[model samples]
Target: MLIIEGLTRRYGDRIAVDDVCLEVPRGSFVGVIGRSGAGKSTLLRMVNRLADPSAGRILWEGRDVTALQGRALRDWRARCAMVFQQFNLSGRLDVLTNVLVGRLNAVPAHRSLLRLWSAEDRAIALSALERFDIGELAAQRAEHLSGGQQQRVAIARALVQEPDIILADEPIASLDPRNTRVVMDALARINREFGITVLCNLHALDIARAYCDRLVGLSAGRLVFDGPPEALDAAAARELYGLEADEAVDHAPALPGPTPQVAPFALHA
Candidate 1:
């Protein structure tokens, strides 16, 4: 379980996130919805320790996450992987090398700097790529792949980390409708198949409502609503997005509910 207590982030006199508290049960798929600058990114960053909270306590499975330092902090980060909106792949690197970067936590600094990846690690990276249907592109440069393909590579990289929790900060914000479905489906499949807890920040109401088991709404910096997707009625959406009744929700047809069936990749001994 993940426990967040009195989480807050301040910039000079302005508060970005205000004393928000939440407890996330393990293996739950949660989507964070809010307008621009509503602190969705900040909240996820604090959980990942990419950003420090001015005041708060973050606990994971009874351990004080906020107090970890040096190697311990690095270990925590490795366990709590993050997927960013912009696919942060090295354009010059091949897809396999990019995915192999996830194993840096276990690689010695000298070996990592020399790009001396072990055969077992290479097998694991290829397995991840195959899981995402991008195994054929393993040797291709990351810059040559389309946005959707790159994002898949990013997900593959995160998977190789073997994280317990995935904090996705608007992962599909830049993709088109088709790729959006593909990416969201992959995330859902990860949660369903591996039981990894997902905390995704999303802007599209339709996507969030369709894929997430629970919806968390924030406005201005405070959490305004937290419940199942059906419980988030028009009124709550309006207040969350500060939109007119008709404009509050995205009325687009919902994405297909079934998780995508990509073949699982098994590691070679």
Candidate 2:
């Protein structure tokens, strides 16, 4: 389980995330949803330790993730891989080499710097690509693949890390609707097959409801709502987006799914 206690982040006078507390059960898929500047990205970044939290305690299996440093911090990062919206791959490098970078923390510094990857690591990288149905592109440079393919490659790289959880920060924001479904399906498959925890920041409400086991709604840095998709009613929707009833209706797309029986959670401070 992952526990986020009083998690907060500030920039000058502005608070990016405010005294938010959330508990994520192991192997669950949680989608963080809000407007563009609602601090969704900052929240995920702090969870991955890519950004510092002003005041908070991130505990994973009783260990304090917030206090880890040096080799310990590097190990924590390796255990919690990040996938970005921009597909952070080396454009000049071949797909296989980019995927092999995930093993850098496990290998000696000299081996990584010299690109002397082990045969075992090469097999692992190739297997990850094959899992995502892109093994044929292993020799192609990352720059040449289409956007959807590139995102899949990014997913493959994250998979090779053997992470306990994936922090996907607006991972599908740059893709078209068709590609969005493809990428979301890939994430779902990973969570289902590998039992890896997934915390994703998403903009589209329908997509969140369709894929996530639970939805976490943030409004201007505050925890506004937490619940199963069915429990997110019209009032909660309005609060999340700061919208009137009419606008809220328009914003929530009609998607078909069974209404989960779980109840909605109370708002946080």
Count clashing residue pairs per candidate. 0, 0
Q: By lDDT, who's the top model here? A: 1
Model 1 misplaced regions, further than 4 Å: 244-248, 251-263, 266-269
* TM-score for candidate 2, residues paired by index: 0.91
Please give, for residues 16-82, the per-residue lDDT of candidate 1 as tens digits. Answer: 9999999999999999998888999999999999989999899999999999899999989988999
Worst 10 residues of 2 by lDDT: 260-269
Model 1 has an lDDT value of 0.88
Q: How well does candidate 2 score on lDDT at residue 54? A: 99
- Tell me the alpha-carbon RMSD of every candidate: 2.1, 7.2
| TM-scores of the models, in the order given | 0.94, 0.91
Off by over 4 Å in 2: 244-269
